[model samples]
Target chain A: MGKEKRELTGAEIFWECLIREGVEVIFGYPGGYTLPIYDALTKYQDKVRHVLTRHEQGATHMADGFARASGKVGVAMATSGPGATNMITGLATAMMDSSPIVCITGQVPTNVIGTDAFQETDITGATLPVTKHSYLVSDIRDLAHSIREAFYIARTGRPGPVLIDIPKDVQNAKTEFVYPTSPIVLPGYHPPRRATGEQVSRALEMINEAKRPVILAGHGVLISGTANQIRELAEKGNIPVATTLLGIGSIPDQHPLNLGMMGMHGKAQANHAVQNADLLIACGMRFDDRVIGKVSTYSPKSKKIHIDIDAVELNKNIKVDLAINADLAVVLRQIIPGVRVRKHAHWTRKIKEWIKDADRRDILNKKTDVLIGAQVINKIWEGTEGKAVVVSDVGQNQMIEAQYYGHDEPHTHITSGGLGTMGFGLPAAIGTSFAVKDREIWVVVGDGGIQMTISELATAVQENANIKIAIINNGYLGMVRQWQQLFYNARYVETPIYSPDFVKVAEAYRMPGYRVDKIEDIIPTMRKAQAHQGPVLIEFVVEKHDTVYPMVPAGEPLHEMVRRPHVPSDAKEN
Target chain B: MQHTIIALVEDKPGVLNRIVSLFRRRNYNIKSLAVGPCETPGVSRLTIVTDENDSIRQNLVCNNLLKLINVIEVEDVTNVPTVIRENVLIKVQVNAQNREELKNIAKERNARIVDEGERSMILEVTESVGKIQATIDVLRPYGILEIVRSGKIAITRGDDRPEIKNGVAGRGTESSRATEQVNNYLY
Candidate 1:
């Protein structure tokens, strides 16, 4: 391919490499520093579509959402200095959530890099703590290779964001455009893929020996496309599955063995099962503080076996009895063969006994005068038949959505799990729209998180994304208010925030809208959203003081959850 | 316990910053760090010594350092059979009567009086860590005007480390990395 030795500017080669990498859409806001690449973009517009985001942070989030939904590497770009700096939060969010994203930032010319020229920022340096890997291109010849390597690194081995900072000089410099088709060898960067045979054997033995084995499924199951494998293993080994928040749809919510999300705001039954389990097999999920509160005392009865792609994750937080550093798919395939086909009927019965107060436990069953967030989400779940891709924002609304939304498919629930960034829902839903054009997309956000990224509505309008946004519009920042109510004397310091007329905001975007202050109108508004052909926003005015229950406050033991207010003795009949 | 880690990284902008950032992120306080070009033109060696005990913790740092894209190799040569050297420049106040005496001490220790002023004498010494410590101890009695010492840089006591390979061998991509084709050749 190089015999002809075709000469091209770095700008042209950059576009070529992107096209080769199967990048159909790029989300970014352009600037002077990246003018060369944008100027070269004119020729590649037909092959690659550029989505102009209102904020650089939104661009990164969109890329993250795209990658999360599509299972492909997402790309975001921005210019130097603030333009690059703005992508920091999104990068961190993707890094924590293990989203594969390639962020390209244009830098000041090489001659002026260290001198801090106008619009110059050491983006590579600033993002080193956040990104999986970063590259600063000094020479034009390295541009193609850097991008190729960046993509490879970003998409592989506990995938996370990788940044490529290209100086404007390098973009304009002439070079023989050699887009390396050959895989770049990174000897030091090999993620330990081949599972240690001894570890796998030991894991199998532990699985067979245990009376109550539980699978703590994490985001890795979805990332590695091992949902089926995990389900098969759980069934064969008679292990109950409890997922982390990011592991939402790894298995169907209705699956007999699925115990929903397990964490601070997880279901009571899931947390209870985990706390009581004898053998805990962690698949792709790190025992983060949020999940395993008080690591020293968390699940003390369990013999832990952690299987992850990154070796760094194991023994970093909680040391397991047996550790297998391999892809979830690889580890599961090997272990499934050796796993005994055993049924723990007594354990399943014990788990069922752990489930209490069905009506009181469910958010929808509460007899409340004010419209509730959970009731609205449950109605939407019914309206979409658990088929819509639900992208939730941070706070009370995100937790409520997780609890209420029933998903039948993996990658259906996309939210900022690690960073828990607010304002992630709307733009991310827009990205999910692009990913699965046919599937109905729903953005579940609180009154607080929505306003942070309200500008992305215009981008969604421009894209004509067929998305339905349900704002759980409580007058205050619900989660913070809940915390204040629980811990403090309910001082409500700067917690009760006011919001603009969200229905008007939706109409202003030329989208359809509705307001549901009444409980009876909740299902009607959801029906209208599901029936609408284009983007729609429904403002569901929820109870301001309502709090998410079964609350294991941060750093508290998983079993030490604050249950909901007392229920009537005949509440189960309701 | 202080552990010395040697890392070889691609000589590119922000590589040093990346290494420093990793140390900060991992909450490892850097005691001293010195870096310079290694035998490879495009590669540089970084000598980073940090206060750390557990061998497992040291191994974790090495693994993380090697995980960086530009980082080619990382070796915790703290306990290895190695030569650790440090250079020092000491300036001491001098007088006519003590000039000969100072020279006698300098000769005893293989240190050279690089610059000798009638009022002051500047001495330069490059020695193993132990020797440098001994020299500093011997010279401190004359009331050192000022002394500057470079951080310890270590190398294993062997013929040499292997030559730096240009491309990653384990990267599973296309098999088109033609061995006959010179990778660094200009168009």
Candidate 2:
């Protein structure tokens, strides 16, 4: 493929490529270095909408959220130096989770690039490890092609962030805009979309022979849009389906065959099933250290059949018996036809018994005097009818939402799964709101995580993003606090951090806010917030020391979970 | 165990940086590296010698190298029947006494006197890694002032070639259609 040449400034060419790539919105913050691009943006304002973010980090995360929610390439823009450095965490988060985002940062003018000029930074070098690929567009003629390539690389294959750092002079330089007319060509980058016949046959053979097969579904299932196929495969073979945190909504949480999330803090039944299953079919998800726990002991009994698009991921983590490096959707389509209808009655009966035990320890079943994070998440789920898009921040709040929110649809639950970045919820929810206009968007964040990027409240207000923010105010970094309490002789350390009154903070941002200390006020306040048309913030002051149970301490095997302590009689006492 | 890997990559700016950074990030220790333009235009070739004994880790490093967007192809030619060479230039302190002895050593080791200084003579040697070490060992009796060695370069002895594992083979043709056909066959 060649280019269609036309005369335009590099900045204008950037916008032209973006417009042709179908970018409707760009989450960005303008600065001195990026003035030329912002200036060019004025001419294309109608075609491309720009949402000014509170910080460059927010912009990156919003772009990430937009990509995850919309399944499209999300774009974020920032200037050089500090602005570019600030987006590192967000870019790393997106990269870790395989979210498709293109971040454009303005560099100093080419002549002074290495002189340490005002607001100049080596952003391409800085982001090289975090980004899937990065470019320093020094030449004006390469501007359009770089932007196109960035978009293509970001959205295709194992999707991740791709950064394009354009120098100021390059943006101002006049050149013939050579827009790529055909599909961009990259010799090194080929995303495999199918499995080999031998691999598929071997996988089918394993699937047919195993009495207890467990499908460990990951974010790949959702990314490849193979949830239906996964469900079909599970039903045809009566295989139990377990999901990673990012894979939560791929299989409906309530499906009979669904074993829920599997990992540390995952359901006890899911963990046990993985440990006991004869055949472990890992689909679209890497066996993260967190998911696999002690790798040597992880799924020790299972003969593994691994399917993923990324070839590097095949034997990188757990050495599987059969590795099928291909797209999950295509692989599932091929294998589902060969899988015979079978029954695993004994395995199902065993899992049902384990589920009963896990349900007995369910925190929601107990009555507590004070509010809890789990209850707040469960109530939000109820209020939204389990239909709202929930963006969760890291730590206990994220786990609580994953456990209690009960996501029933794919893309409904968006979180920074691999990186576990705090302060992701609000901006991500805002991005989700932009991606999905009609669906109710919710931010489930902890007080600690929310404070990390609390400034995004203003972004939500300015964008008029109809997102309901739920701050699980536990007055501590609950996840760390739990670890300290359990493993560090209860030394609280700096976990007990203070926070400003969130309601007043929300009000300062010119958005309606409410604080709920009692369980009774939770639903009412939530209802009031939902009734509001714009962004609304609700602070739920939960029990300070409540922990996320079913904890599999680091290096422990999947089945060796520290179950939630059973409050035998009255649940009133702490 | 030392492994020799060769890669063909797009000769674009920062491509070398990406490859080197990937090695650093992955903690794969590179014992020696040499990069130059290959027979193909606009495609650079890299020969890297990494000290990794684990076969799994070696495979991982090769896979990670291929993950780089500029890297077109990668192959570990350690176990293959191949011709490998390293060129070394050693400047040995000669003076009047040891000059003839140095010349005799260079001739015996198939080395050449590339440069001669007032008091030191530079001998260039192109040989296998072990032979180069042997030549250097023989010249150690004369005080060596400086040494520069091309890391490594390797090629197959016969017509054996590394498989085209990436999308380079689909170039010029409609890659989308080619990919679809490949997908159909694989699926």
Candidate 3:
């Protein structure tokens, strides 16, 4: 069959490529230069559903939420200048969390570029640090290839955001278009494969030889779909696994070998194990500053073996005894067989003893009448049966959720980690609700953080998203207050936050709201909020000065923790 | 250790400011820098020399320069043999008595006589720093009027193509030849 290739504009090619990539939805707002792409999108309404956002920032966060929830490349479109600049924060957030997103923007016309024309800005230049890669389409013919490449780059190899800026003239200019069906080949962009045989053998030898070995799992394990493999290896070898904050769900928390989280605000036993281990098999995690407090002192006695997908991150921070650059799943698949099925009865017994000792000092068993943030989050987790998509805002509430919430699924808990953007949860929840409308979506935010982007409530009302908003109101920025208390000699300073009646605000948006002050009313209030027809906001007044326990001071090793600043009487008991 | 780094960045507004800010923020010591238009539209080439060690230089290349959305490629040319040149146009005061001597010196150095007014003569010299300095020394006798020198631009010797290494087309590797062809056709 003879088929003639016809000329197509960049805008047309972009739509076609997006359809080919199975992009069913796009969130964006149109402007002067982006009108052509919008026109093309109009022609393909059946193939793609475009969500018009109130602002560019909302659109980007929506894309981010979609990506985080569905594990697919989220797409957003915006015009140049302020439209593109507003997307930088969202893009950076996605980049940090390793979410796949593609941000498309319009550029000034080809002829008037650099002339300071109306609605012109170098969108590509502004997003360099935040994106995995970027392309500026000056020619129409390159649009199809660029879009395909953008999708590939965004979805593969340490998944992150990629941007493509198309000039107005190029969008209208026509060329022969060919949609690529196969994977695009990019030089110098190959993601590392499984570890070599020598590396696996060396790793196995270390695992078998060590008397005390711990697995430090990170988000890379979950991203690579190696959680089951990791579990199998850990179970077979009787290795205790400690997870980073982002790696919370890499292994089920209920698993006996799981040591919970490590570092500041981590479980006491988990941090202790990390500090005292003889060998740390760090899998799929970059040792961020938070994880390795006082870098020189962290793991002073342990030999660290780091495995990561990005080669650049292998030795960028803490030195590794063995650095293997490979996909976690591939590496795990290969290493699991080589590992000898040996039982470290001594190591398992020691960890179990520590866990038992920790259980005796269980903070939840104190029978406190006052509701706490941790208790509230734990109740929500229990009520939802660990099935809800939990979106957390930054600060103490985010840390508490990371510590206490039991995540049984991948991408279940969405939070802004690296950037730690405060106003991330509400919009992110709204976005998550859209991605999986039938599932129960909950936004857990602090009073201070919620006030930043509370206006997005109107978006929930408009979209009819039945999202449950849980405000852990502590009357201050709890995390900052805790830091000030410890580091700043308890001088509260400007951490205090005063807010209006959240019920009134929710009512103003025609949504239901509730306030829970007593510890006994927490579960019932959450139940009522969940039972509400549309979006519901529940405010919980937590203890004003309560601190998250087992905190490693700013530059202290994980095991050398303050133990929750115990009262004098409790200290006497110890 | 002195090192020369070549980078390709999108030619956009405030790029220079961002580059300067990055250097200042990262505390990287920059000895010299040159920026100019490249063969591809919308992209410019920058050559910078610094005295930082290899690791620090690599950090500057990967973490700082490459972090800039506009910057597409960064390469270290410290170990590569290269030719560096700059153009300087100097207007000198000369009379009939010393004109012949100055002209002879200029001819010897292959400098071009751009303009000659009644009071002064302007000579354009394109050469290495040492040769340019020698020519300037020779012309100092004729009384230098105005001197303006462009920043040093460098290219590696032999057939090592920096553009291809930087992921630009023309001399890309075998796998990238298709992209090169497409890029060529588009441009």
Candidate 4:
């Protein structure tokens, strides 16, 4: 009838809290400051699995990747000072994309928290801007509740990363741990879940009245598990759907109404549809500058309706006519009953017309001498049957992956969207490996980004992650080079970033690594990667001059796109 | 236009630094900020004023402040029907010649001479911002030495208690999904 009597040290309570929270694995690295938890981890090694990452950033990204892939809150751990500092980028990335991840970092002993003792840093102060919430726990009694609160805050109301900075003394202290069976109730926090009837009716009236309407589905749809609801709403209304870069796979990419990725490097029809639509229904997506080129001209004819779970995101950019601050699934499901099914054959045909010259403009058309970035991704797409969880680094390869990968399921494609942080691919894919044990995990990275976090290869090998890494080796930071070639007088200053022998590097990790250059070698190389028993790395030397097409230069209208240059057969550069 | 915002936050170390940094990160300048312990056991209230004209920017700052972990609630109390006050202590240069004049000004303004020196005297007053500004205007006649003033702090007037939804009652010691506990407090 009273509290259960269980005596445990704070470190033991740490692992016990994780087990109670349903955490099956942790991606982390141990250091001096984290000895207590690491020591306690040894006892609970059978209860919870821990994956050692080469770098703290890699660990957080892995956790993020796991969270994205499994639709569960991922956990990362590290020690004090640099360990917590290194997690900044990953935590920021998770914050940007609304990924649910909890990072636990060790602090110096409570006595020296501010004295700058060995390996001590004011992490809570430093990470305030990036994390949804953070707790600096020095008392053993507060340790379990802080962790429980961290998990709760990280996963609810537009999921994000939460940090728990536990001092070594707290971890070593012993307390009567009653593993908080009751939920943590923070007075100030509440996640909005449902839309008002008036807002729904207003949205429906706009939907019914529109002649040319487009639905912009975003990553929120995936987070809220509303892909089916979005599909139903789109299908019932016969509205074409355009996806943001992170919004990819929210709806089946193969669906007829799915207009593919939209924004700067989005497909032609999708961009055109957003520009021309009379009514734009934005579901679970924020209209970032990357998605909407110029707020003044975006969807010029549309009366916009923005539906998002984060109330704070509505009208932050591109003010909408009707804003529904609620869960995407809740809003979509509520409105589906009130929504009337209709046909918009002419509108769909109009959009299809913009997609007319897709064949000649397609990357598949480059079947000549050397390999292109898109071809390599398409090959992997074919080998994996468009079902693999494709994690990509930012830049040219990221764009090409978007252009080529035929995503068929939600949570199948993970990338650094809001932050667009480079060097996220390898570790994130390794994290995804733990999530879908049976499915293929592919890493589409660039030569430049691969070098940024190449040390992650050690983690991949250690975990024996069943992943296939395809490095689009262009011998340069291709995205910057493309931007230079287009905008700044083609001065390739510091753009030609050379990388060391990646095959040799992969060899160091003891995984089979191959360099594929010829266009014909793409498929065979991808197939070989799939056949490898463990993680395999393939460096495909692609054309350095290649660029992502349909470029809507920043600050310009979405309708204004610069097409790729046409090279005649006689005017070959190579 | 100026905006005055009141925020309730958890009483913890480095909270002021966090709030100030958020403003700095957004490149917004704070005119003044005053913080003190509230009636609640572990809660402090912050009253901040910034010289920003745009309501949208003001709302954004409020939203961002609300996102901070320790922040419980934020409200723009400027131009509202509320009880607002600031305290000012001005140590002004004086002699037998100007002391009578300074005393008259202080008495007219309902101020008091809390401290006095041979060459200077301190005028202390707790009043509305408008009254404080008026008093400062009156004190300007005398040579001012050092001035220290508390920033604006406010509470709503009358039966207009804009729900302190994050009351002590919300932090239940019982176990429940954070959301389930939050459901009772949803506005």
Candidate 5:
């Protein structure tokens, strides 16, 4: 207790506050401005561990991945100027996904802040839109509270990333550190944890009256830890459950009533169920344009009920009949008791008919000599038994993973859904490696995305992170190429990209690497990579001209998706 | 439809920038805005008037403003019974012939000539936005040298509103009784 009376430097206070916030690890890189904090880290080495990432962007994504996988606030740190700016894309990705991450950046000395001195930048101003909240700490006394507030705001209601940019002068200044034990009282921030009884009753009434009900589960179900509650409601009411891309594992894929993802590249049956349902219960999801295509005709027959933690998301996209702004699990807990066990045999049969040829349309059944991205993903799924924490990068590979990799557990399928940032998978998988110990972790990235943050392989090797990366090497920016091929008269300009020998790159990082072009080699390469003691990479040479199927063109109705040509029966677009 | 929104925020540096940045980022149109110290020692009040008619977007903007950690409370007073005012200063070029005419115009519009110089006279007026615009329009013929207007500020009427304490109070009621008391004493 006498130690508390002694004054602490701001650098010590920064680490002290983080320790008080229950932070065990930080993903960061050090520079001139952060030298003092790094020195302070030497003092608290045993209490807190720092992972030295190759780049600040990778650090941010690693923090984001940690947050998404473990449901705890992830921490990332960096120096000023370029370092802070590099974290923008990752911060934006976390913002769009509602991941809880605390990003700390060391700023230039207070005297030189606005002089545009060496490595100085107005990061707080630049990151205002991307962060849920941010603090620029100039005073020594405010450092602890600013960090405390940052963690509180970042982890509370509808969690997202928050940043604290600490000037070097503040880090060196001395102050008596008092970690505030009183609960944070921000008069402006009140995250509702429970829905009003009347709203819950109204939702139940709408649920009970509809003959066809489809519950659209989203990432909030995972964040709120309500997958079981969601399944309970769906099963009790005989409702089919559809999910947005980020909502992949809200309901177990093997469950009888679980319809697959519903969005731009969602399954045909999932989209059809949403379009034809009489009551659509959207839980913990914002109605992104990708989810509700052609908003004017989206679920014309459904009396929609939207339940989300963020109030702004309730009516931001599709206007609903009842909007309940509260925690999804709490709201479902309220409504579950009153849910009537109703029979929808005819509606179920209709959905079954819609799903009859889904398996046939899957790329696995195709007798293709050339490897396709979907087939490779399916093979990886078989190799991992679909239990690995799979982080997918954006583009056609992302869609292929979502389609073929069935996640039966919540928080197993993580992707950058809203911002759709490339280069997210590798560092993010590394992040999950630290979060859940002894579990298999995988990063499914495309040839293009993997190259974007490919340098993180060094960080992976340095951390000795047990992560296996599957690069779906299509030799082109496959998604954009698909768009150009279908919409721009097959103009292939600038889409085909050149990649170095990925196996050599992996070898350069001192890890085992494999390249698989033939279909028969896919599983063996996966086994070899999985057997390695540390990080490994497998470059999958897929067909150059394959496309993701069941794609709803931009702004098209969800039900009118383009089906794959090889499907036996439902090849015709509805 | 125009909404008169009042927000109570922490009195700190860059708070206004945060609000303005939020409005700009969200694409919310602000017709006029004003901020000043309130009864609270560490709290400031912001009066924002938006002409956008989409209630859904307005609600979203209000909710977003509320999300700012510095922002304490936000109320859309568009439909509330409130007393609204704007302060305007109009500088007009005056000559021997038009001086008397300008005086008559200012008198009729309930505006006072606060400063009379050799080249021009400045008319000071505190009125509703529509009245202030009308007063400026009438003085325009005398060759308006310059004009500046304080954006609209509004406070809800009646005693049911929150009472002003040492450092915080309900946004709309803090100044209503003070304004009424000053007006009654002046009359």
Candidate 6:
């Protein structure tokens, strides 16, 4: 048969584009408005696997996990109104971490769009800020193009979530489908390329001229696949590398230059090194307030060389002496060759000294009465032998894990960085296990954030994803409380959180669980959790009012760090 | 003297209250606003049109809008022939004496009478700036019992879609085209 010019519905065309885009699976649920798309999926069942989630939120989180693990565009489908709204939190989480995800939602019929009919919602309006981009396809002819654009936007540049809300009438209308062979043509979207020669030269000059230079890496290093290059740069320049919470695995925690995560819950040495540096090379990081702490006082002794793909981030928070707008990978490739192998023995010794001092000041020593968050994370990491995908919810536990866990690979340490999204751990862990079924996935969450989306435990049970959950239950919004302690004159405000019996909640979901009040029970319970065939929840009733020290107060410069109240000298004397 | 203001706000309960509270708190007059979804989910967009000139509006967008977590992106689209519209529903006091006159006025303004009662009339108007204002003026004499107006929602005209590229409409003159191209590639 000759290539027949046959008309197809928008929903069909959208599916056809997905096939061309090499989509292997989609997590979603069917609804009244989205039935047409589900109908199309029936024909493409062999090529695309569709996992029906218990709720739209679960479906989106599953897609996000799939994207992070597979390094491909994750797709989720939902119907209009509440279904679309349900996916909002998941979408925001992916956006903050720059995870690539494509969300397809069905809208009410075009004619009844503004009428607020049954199951009708303005999803395009609802998801605008959280998505990297969104499309409201009003015409059948635009379906193929819109779908193509959605995937393209999702996977390209600083990858993030994109939404395509297709009105029911548009899905039903017929039009000739012609899948674009090339990339979608968008007029406004452009990601920076590798830094130019001049930029590389300036960076190299700054590196050579500085007495003490430090590399502050964020998640961008992994996203850009420049971890090896970063190591090379660090090794050649003999520069110490400090990471943000999301940047945990960008460099191995065991590396000599690695100073661990820097922030409220950062190590004393890492925080001190950042403050004392003469020049700071910040890569693929947005200078989150947690890292810079009191921006005005941060790194007062240093000149910042800010390198990021997004230009708006250059001088956004911490001003820079040299700004390079380029993809981390591309810029790293250029700088690798230009970097000279020079030893900063004096600087290296200073960092080493700080590390030794920090080790002595370990708050979680077996003798301590208080259950230290760091000790729990270290024990869990040791027990898992670095085999599990560690997903952390935002707060003190997240910071502690970032400091303690030895992440050796990309996508292994998953946490919300840019958005600092709470209630992200459980769902993300659920999604991660779905992506890597054979591997162990552990979700490290705080009491406050976990409660926000604890409902996702039901999703885990339904999916039969055997993820291990560790709740660092401190009976408060740990991160907010830390800030209030440091910046708000210890007003405490509403940071205190009262929670239900997490063990009972887990049992209700048919998941085995344990509560560990004593530090001694942590390792045994974690081991028991790991051995379980299905999902398990291990709650650690940590001490309340335990501040994550070495805090860089909000608006304070990075250098002026607040050392832990009990310094190494004080601890040694005791 | 036209200004474009964009706002990024949290997508949560009572967000509108927080936004309304902001306007009330600042006492800055908002002439028109277009709010919708942004590139991410669980976030809302607010595009404000104000009488304040470019510099002052820029300060509001940067300082006021950017400062709010619920408020995300603020841009001034006044020069771009943006498609701005508002939905207004007015319940007017109407009796047999003025019913015909009110109907004639609604017809002239292309407004529809959604519901009617013996003593009250609910008139709905979905229109551009001038027509919406004109319709509101005509109803003032009849005594509007209750009037509800949605903030302006807008999109730039002529296929300059922001969704296709991240920085298309927002970038200033110097690197607008380049920024759009880069955004397209990255997206």
Best candidate per DockQ, number? 2
DockQ of each model vs. true complex: 0.21, 0.34, 0.09, 0.26, 0.19, 0.05
Better of 2 and 5 by lDDT: 2
lDDT of 3: 0.80
Docking class of 3: incorrect
Question: Which predicted model would earn the best TM-score?
Answer: 2
Give the winner by TM-score: 2 or 5: 2
Task: Please provide TM-scores, in order, for all candidate models, with all chains considered together.
Answer: 0.92, 0.96, 0.83, 0.95, 0.94, 0.75
> Compared to the true structure, candidate 2 yields what TM-score?
0.96
Q: Candidate 3 residues A1-574, lDDT tens each?
A: 3434767877888898888788888888899889999988778999898877767777778888887777778898999888988888889888887878899999899999889898888777677667887888887877887888888778776788999999989989988876665446563354556676778888888888887899999888877777888898889888889888888887887898899988787888887788888899998898887788888888888887898876556667787788887777777887888787878888888888877766665556555667888888888899898888899999999998987788876678888877888888887887787678667899999999888778788877987777999999999989999999989999999999899899888899899989988878878888888888779999898889988887888887667877743343343245
Instruction: RMSD for all candidates, in order, please.
Output: 4.5, 3.2, 5.7, 3.9, 6.8, 9.8
Clashing pairs in 4: A182-B175, A182-B176, A183-B175, A183-B176
* Two-way TM-score contest, 1 vs 5, winner: 5
lDDT (10s digit) by residue, model 1, range A280-305: 99999988888887787788898999
Predict model 6's lDDT versus the native. Answer: 0.77
- Sorting all predicted structures by DockQ, with the top scorer first, yields 2, 4, 1, 5, 3, 6
The CA lDDT of each predicted structure is 0.84, 0.88, 0.80, 0.85, 0.87, 0.77
What is the two-chain DockQ of model 6?
0.05
Q: Supply candidate 3's per-residue lDDT for A311.
A: 56
Interface RMSD of 1: 9.7
TM-score, cand. 5? 0.94
Error of 1 at A170 (Å): 3.2
Question: In candidate 1, which residue pairs get closer than 3 Å at backbone N, Cα or C atoms, i.e. clash?
Answer: A185-B168
lDDT of candidate 2 over A116-155, digit per residue (tens): 8998889999889999999999898778778877877887
In candidate 5, which residue pairs clash? B40-B167
TM-score per model (chain B): 0.83, 0.87, 0.78, 0.85, 0.84, 0.67
A177 in model 2: Cα distance from truth in Å?
A: 2.5
Cα lDDT tens digits for candidate 5, A1-574 = 2335458899999898888787888999999899899999988999999999999999999999988888888999999999999999999999999999999999999988899999889999999899999999989888877887788778767889999999999989998777665555666666666666678788888999999899999988888888999999989999999999999999888898999999889998999999999999999899899999999989899999998878778778898898877767678889999999988999999999888867657666676788988889888889898888899999999999998899999999999999999999999988888887867999999999999999899999998999999999989999999999989999998999999999999999999989998888988878888888789999889999998988999999888899985555433442
- lDDT by residue (tens digit), candidate 1, B1-187: 9998888888877788888888888888898888999787988888899998776677678767866767877777777787888888999988988999999999989999999987999988899878988888988888799988888898888796733222221211211121222222010
DockQ of 5: 0.19
List, in the given order, the native-contact fraction of each candidate.
0.20, 0.31, 0.00, 0.17, 0.27, 0.04
